[model samples]
Target chain A: MSINKDTIVAIFLLLFCGIMINSSFDIEDPGYQGMKASFWPTIVLCLLSVMSLVMLIKSMVSTTDNNLNSENTNSQNIFLKFKNASICFLMFILFLAFLDYLGMLIGGVLFVFGLLTLLGGFEIKKIINHSIISIITIGIMWSIFTFGLKVILPEGEILRIW
Target chain B: MIDVILQAFASIVLDPVTLGLMFVGTLAGILAGAIPGFTIAMGVILTLPFTFGMTAIQGLATMLGVFVGGFSGGLMSCMLTGIPGTPSSVATTFDGFPLVRSGRPGLALGLGLWSSFFGGMISAVILVALAPQLAFLGLEFGPWDYFSLIIFALTITVSLSGGNITKGLIAGLLGLFAATVGEDEINGVARFTFGFDDFKQGFAFLPVLIGLFAFSQLLTDVEDDKRAKSPLMSQSGTVVKVEHRQAILIILKRWVNLFRSSFIGIFTGILPAAGGSISNILAYDQAKKASPNRSNFGKGEYDGVIAPEAANNATAGGALIMMMALGIPGDIVTAVMLGALMIHNIIPGPTFIQDEPLLAYGVFIAFFVAHFFMVGLQAFSLRIFLLVTKIPMYVLASVILAYCAIGVFALHNIVFDIWVMFFFGVIGYFMKKLGFPLAPMILGVVLGKLAELNLARATGISDDMLLFISRPWSLFFLLMAVISVIFPFYQEAKKETLFAKLYVPVSMIVLSLPLFLMGSPVRMIVAVILVLTGAYFLYKRTSSLKIT
Candidate 1:
């Protein structure tokens, strides 16, 4: 598996952090006896991590089977790999931050446009078309959610007056 | 039984909402399915969360529409572009695409449209009439039967997990093992929990699905197009006319092949793990098997188009029967349907049939009517969609990613889930790269929680663990599970060597201790089987250094 060990580590770290944080949630309360509500999933994370750990170890200890065939050997460009994944991570973090702050529609438009322009480097005309289309799409989406399904979506300062 | 039919007809024919949604879903699904790189499986997974807010009938009706439309939509690409829009339509592309290339596009579309619709309607009629009988069969299942079912479903991964048996087995085992990570439902003992609360709730099935299909694809797209992915398929030409008499003659000539494929589709649909893609492949192969013109099977034979189109479409109807009435899903689409049902707090099974016959029957109506609308509407729009098939997939890909983002954000009005979606997406992308079968993994996780829940409830184990598999129902599933867990490696050995493989049973005699300790006679059977199978595979792996 070509999955970066860091990403897997990051996932486990996040799970570990969640376990720590949630465990702090009313630690004093006597939970489900013989098994707290958190008990099963906690077990799951450890097991998953251990499995990940085994995977990591196997990945590390295994000899390059690629020795048998050049095509099977995967030698990647470090910079390109780093650049793509970093950009992806950045896009996600930014989407979260923007949506949390500006609301889904406006934030979503910016994210879509930004991801396209920054990651893709599309022509300016394409960028504009993408932006306009995204805004309209999100707008229809917002209406559908709020009016049709009545799902309470994030209303930015623009729509709070309503 | 007659009342059930009447109820289905009455609810579907008369209910405006059910009919309308089914129509809408069918049209939209066809559009989605006909496009390049857009799969119905992903469509089903993506929409599952949205269904959380809907009532059971409405939600199920929507998915049913999507299923019908998605399967039929693949024909659009086949007739227009020569590329099958979905994998199931691969055979259709052989014949339908050739006709388009021959400037007989309309003929191709006419054939594909009629074939898909006929197969769908016929199978759906069978499903509507026979689903209750099938559901009763499912109701007879015990834990072991379900366990065996999961086993059979999981085994299919070996066939599909790319060439290496070890790789497939490892991947399948990883999925099964991943399933065990969550809480032990039988004892409330967190078997693998390292204290994470989310871990206790177990992994979110939808997010994992997104990771495997959406994220994985997105990552691959990013790399392939230098990351500027478009989800659309480019195309050309419009439908050509075939004489009315010729069309009828064509259908009748291929009637035997068509019926066989349809039945294959329905049976496959009923089997968990084997979905439309498998049925399509199996049906296409069967058509060739039965055809005197087998050599022409791949070179634009009508049977090539009819076989898969019929089977893939038929499977959709069959899947619904199990999902709506039996609670268990036969494949991913129905698996998503299962998630949708939980949203409405409606448990599917005999109880659902007894309590909500109207809802169940109404869904049948939705299936029939949606096919009707798609058939009627596409009859006119077929030419337009056919001519415009040249749009690139990269542009389409961007739009779907955009919608995926929007979908995640719309649910819970929270960005957290969006991140979750992205997180899973990236994971899915990487997992695919590594050669793991994420579908089985997702299945394992989805059923893992429930399996654990049922196991716990059945055991009352703290009081007495031995009683867990004592019931006939539990015992049956347990025996099946035992056979299921070990059979793959055994099959691998038997296929590889005939005589020396007899020693495979030697280890079975030795590793009988651990399962015996698990206490349940059913599980002990499984344990002994696992030990022997694992040993045999370990031997095979050491001996065969060649990965192929």
Candidate 2:
């Protein structure tokens, strides 16, 4: 009784669309309109819902006919398989969250260096290499945006000096 | 006209300062185009401020150089990395990156570069010779026609879906849903915001684009620890060179495809709001349908690279024709150029060519000359671009992600865009893993607003839905849409199938209805010919079937 991955995805999408369609009703309709604001979104969501249902049914049929547990192979240790991507994504979120506080220059350098160590290795030599590459790369980018294009990069809130 | 063109050419080439500025602008445009999340429109907008101090010809030339270079610059990153540097280059990755993966980066780069050059040259000729006439075609499209045309464009999702039609449809529907999240343009009502103010803006197109194509791609590249530490490409030992001679011969052999794709680009460009993004994909779809080796398209076919690369570059010339002759901006880049012209106290309209002959012709010459410069400059810069493959995947991914952040932030100077990028990236990554094709989704997002807007406008104009079928242009697009939707099925059908046998003649007969309705004598004659040819084919097929 293993649920196929695609079946789960389809069910999730159907639920999301159901939620969206429900919310479409809450949209404030400014009575003066030829078509309501929710008209297009509702149509799109209905189509999505139909397609998701189709996907769900198709996946279920295929799974039944084949008597296959495709999900079992990959679903056992999903976290282990996606650990690197998960960490990278977490780092990305953290970097963006504290971007204003750390500024692009310092923030960018740290982000790059951390990613490099996480992705490459944490050996002392690799750390030094990562440090140099991060600083140089971030420095050049910062200089180009700040100087050449005249685009003002975000100076950190705390590090802001007149 | 010849004298005016010569005068324009002399002004651009003879002046060192203008030439220097154009050169610089082209280089800058290439840099902008080669970076993921950076757009050609942004490059032109940045160059716009610098143009204010220069003479009208110099200013236009500089911007035109950027415009031309940016279109071609996208191919470098597209082939080297799976990520498209610009939205227009998205289709290039279909075959270009796969070709790179197959260890022919040189051939792919050369093909892309040369195709762009030829496509640009073809469109430039048309722009100069028939700007007024072609610009007039743009005026013929009503909201009904535009909506129908988008419907036709949306049918490409069938072709993009590969083997999973249901997943593709769901992905496309999701994209359309995403577009509908923001405030309604005509009426200022938010539909899917859910009371969150940040969601009102919905997803900015660029952030979504970068997130889906660039950020998600980077995550995939670094998903495996061992793979992340290695260089981007496997061909680490060999020095990659652009196989210019080989590429030229290959392009020359496929002259019909090159010409057809360029024409497609030019036509799409002439239509307002339809830009390089649409043109490239349209060209790729047409190429795939026409190619004998259609199955090889997403698997690294040369036709795939040639069609998109050529079409996107040609689109610039098509856009310029509308801007110069009709006072209409064909796309965002041309819209910015139009603003630059207005800044110079020049207004473009129906009589713009008559009023500002020198400046108008200057634009034509500059556009032509910029292609030459793009070819020369790209040849040199491509060597440097190839070095990107040598960087470790992790390093490249991290750096590109940072650039993606910066580029997205720079677009609006807002932190919200960065968040949008991250959110979409996660969704895109999941979609990829689930085997839901991303191309259809991207197409849906790009065309969704235009489709909705036109649909609304069409309905508002008249309560009678019969107008959608009665209008010649609308009917024409509807026919094309029907054909486009069934094309994949037709292509996949066995040769013995009745559907396969009837597909060509039926398509011809059905498509000719619009031509006949057009009322022009030439079009009527063409329609008559089509009917005769289609009838002849139908008769032959029926006769053969009876004998069998």
Candidate 3:
């Protein structure tokens, strides 16, 4: 039997809440008026646990209505869609990594150019124009926040000199 | 008060920088709001980091401009493309598109803008008068009362959860748990940090917000772009010149619907979690019920456009009342705005009004000024907004992703927050696909800490958890929460087990036993309510079962 998305969510949340509750044990309880540092998390996790269990039961009981969960249509379609979107997602991850090392201004410009290139039908001319626009836009954004507003942005190891 | 208001108004108007920022915010709001997939909350959030440099008045005025302009701008798409620019504009499309198709797009747009302006003005007037009174009432709330009030506020989730009570509850609970990740407010001990220094300070509110709403939407837009080509409007440059005089006369004739819808908007806006999405639909429903030309509502009736547009815009004003007076946000946009205020180290509470009267008055005046700007701009710049709507999804997504990254980075100059945003973005996207509502979860995060802090304080003060129900207001809110949770199910299932019918009320009554043992009148009243409701449910359930 294939696990429906709801069942998966429930199981994941159950495990998450379990971990959360267990971790609460590590904190020193204040024990004042039977309330402590762990009190609220305990209450929240307890409610979450109950609700997650209910969701699991409901998902299990209504397996016939699995079609109601739209994401469960077909594994292949889901994968293809995820794969298509993964290009952008990958660009996002790369952008974050770039921002970490290359600084906000340079990293932002590169991130925009790369994402636009992937999105721009792969025509060199279109990619070049999109990159130009992306650079101008990112430049303006960087100037406004970094220079105009005096907000700090990452300068990268190499770019920190200038 | 009058002098302060005058000074605030003068300061905003005379200062070109502040005025220009407000203008920019309004223009950006109109463009963003006209986009089919963008929400006003996203507009406000995208504008938040921009405000970090300005003073409280300048920043807030700019945000308010966006708030008003965004609400007004949704009708552009609704009229031009049959797409509701924001969730609040969903009802606008019902009659608005038909009007566009009927060749009076100009009239529909004109009516919607005027309606929104009037709605905004009316709510502002009411806010100016009512907020102080509410603030006074807010000052009376103790920890227990505040906790109860939050319970009552959270009942709004029942109405908002898109008919998935269990999922909504789960989402809200998860949010509360997420809020507990940082150091404990009472003991300074970390509960859920899992040994990470980044987790110790907990997830910053802005990062979580940006992730949930803006970044998640970006990812979803990307997915949608991959799945199907987005349908673009046919005539991207078409402009229909509205006969303003005729439209104003038509609006003037429907004064009753205007005022009534605006009032409904304000009332719903005051209810936490029930924002424009609820108010606009309600206003439209009430207009349908009250209008002489009910048949024309969905057939391109001008009153139909007016009802929702007016109501939705009015909600901005109504929501501000709760935010300013009580320190609690009534909806997502206000919630973000609350975060904005908090970022400036201005804590909102009963004393918020007193402590920051000048700024408070400045916000009120700003709302009024924003309406004026929105009206003036939309009148001459409809084509500009139309062009903005035609921006390609991928281009917008890429820009939004970059903004999300850069904006979060600018918040604390920390890279960890970016990761936090990315993580929640994935969660939010999947949650949307799974039909779990995001608003409840957001409300949970925003209110969870407030609820827990107050509940813990109340626990400390009273030395008994059950003593929360000993107060009259506390008991009332708890009882309301119980009813709110059950009422949806009761409506869904007309026939249920008799045992099930008695479960919640019986448990609540039993739970109130400590108060009863303490011989408090509050418990007696609560017990009576539970008994009556329980008996009624039992009677209905048994009769329905027998009939079936």
Candidate 4:
């Protein structure tokens, strides 16, 4: 009775496709020349639904044939394994969320330093190394974008300076 | 023509300032190409303003240097970082990174560089000899034919799917769906937006590309602490040399692959709107199909690296030919170049060569010479690039991610693109975990807009759905698409099934029909030869069956 990862993913994708297909109907046809805007999206969603259904059936059949509990067991371990990556991804999200406040100069440097520490370790030597690398890398990047390319990096609302 | 070419060559070579500018442009292109989100089109656009002050020939030559160099530059990042620097080099990363992982980084780099050089050379020669003829061929493709061609290109998803065909199809469908999320280009209807203002613009191709390939790749690289602290390449301490001689020999040995891939690049490049992205993947698929060691393709096969690198570089020459001969920009980079040409009061078309013989020939020379500069400059630049391997994974990942964010932001100065990159990165990571191939999805995203645009155009012209298969060019592409779809299955069956046995003969017979209908003597003769070959094969198969 245990559901495998593939089966779960297939179900999720199938539901997504159903939702998309439902949304496609709301698009105004306009009765303009050529196919409606919904036409291509609907065709793609239908194909996606079919493929997801196939995946679901295939995974279910295989699971039944093998009757393997390993996948179910391994599913729990997968969450534990993704701990480092999850933390890193969260840090990235936080960096973006605070980007307008801190600006790319500060935000970028802090994000790099934070990621480096998260990934490399919390040792004093590693922190020093990470800080230097962060400042140098972000400084070079900011200079290039602002001066070389003449692209305006976000200056932050708090630290606004012309 | 000879006089024009000689004059053009003399003008470019004799001027040190022009040559220096070209050298500098090539270097800039390489740097731009090595960055994950910094595309060749961006590099050319940056160089456009600089070119305004120079003479037309000087300006064109400088941009051409950037164009050619940018194509070759992508392989460095692809091989070293496992993230393609540009979309065209996406396929190169398949084998190049794996080869680097397998401790053959030198060979992989060398193979990529030399293949790019040779491919560029071949395309340049073709551009010189057959620009007019090839540009005319490009003019023949209608909306139906273009749509069919995209369908044929989409068949690569099957080949790229690896072992899981269902996941691959789903992934591709998801990509196509992603492209349809914004307002419809043709009718301006909001699609799948659900009141989100950001969704109205749709997902840009670059952010999606960087997220799926670069960001997701970085996440995987730093999955654990041990892997995170380590260098990108395990053998980082060793002095990695670009084994030029050995790579050249290998490329020479695989001359057929080289020629075939280059020709694929050139042919795809000639078609307006079709560019290196399609050609590289097409060449890689074709290489996989034709290779004796096909199983080794994704696992660091040199042929895989060679095919895509070669195709992408050759694409520049093909694109330039279209721009110079027909006033039609083949791809975005050429579109930028077309803008540059227009700024200089130069208009390229059917009578352009006659009117501006020296300038036209100068462009050809610039393109041709740019390859030589690319080869020479890559040798020096690659050494500097290899230093990236020495950086710890954590530092490299963090820096690259920041750059990705900045690059995405700079693309349109939008924070939404950064979110798109992050979202796709998460999705890409899971897809990799679930064993869904990423290449097919990337291909889907890349071609989705073009396919929909063409389909809309085709349908808008006439409600006759039959025109898709009735038009000569459209029928040819449709037939090719059918063959391409069956090819993977045919490869698996390998003459065991009746369908497999008849695949070659049937393909030849059907393919010849379109050529025969093309109404040119050369095409008719080629069609006749194809029919004869097909008949001979059929006769031999029947005879063998009777004996059995």
CA deviation > 4 Å runs, candidate 1:
A1-88, A119-122, A157-162, B1-7, B49-53, B141-205, B226-231, B239-245, B380-394, B461-496, B499-548
Worst 10 residues of 1 chain A by lDDT: A65-74
Residue lDDT tens for model 4, B1-548: 77887899998988898899899889888866876546786677556655655789998999999899999989888887787888899999899999999989889989999999999999999998887675457567788887877666565545534657678778878878888888888899989888999999999776787777667877887776676777655542333678999999999999999999999999888765567888899999999999999899999998999899889999988888867775655665775676667667776655677788898888888888888899899867766556755666677778878887887777667889999999999999889977887766776776687779889898889999999888998899889867866766777885656777788998999899999889999999999999999999988776666434
Query: How far in Å is the alpha carbon of A148 misplaced in model 1?
Result: 2.1
lDDT of 2 at B2: 84
Chain A only: TM-score of every candidate?
Answer: 0.59, 0.88, 0.85, 0.89
lDDT of 3 by residue, A31-89 (tens): 55536887788888998899999988888877564553476577777776675367767
Pick the winner on DockQ between candidates 2 and 3: 3
Q: Give the TM-score of candidate 1.
A: 0.78
Provide the clash count, candidate 3: 0
Q: What's candidate 2's DockQ score? A: 0.49
Candidate 1 docks at the CAPRI level of acceptable
TM-score for chain B of all predictions: 0.79, 0.68, 0.89, 0.67
Model 2 Cα lDDT, one tens digit per residue, B306-422: 999999999998888877865655665775676667657786665778778888888888898888889889866665546655677788778867877876776567889889989
Tens-place lDDT per residue, model 3, B53-144, is: 88988889999988899998888887887878888888999998898899887888889989999999999999999998899978867899
Candidate 2 per-residue C-alpha lDDT over A31-148 given as tens digits, one digit per residue, 9 for 90 to 100: 8647678888888899889989988888777735223344545654577668778878988988988888999999999999998888899999989999999999989878877775
Docking class for model 4 is medium
By DockQ, is 1 or 2 better?
2
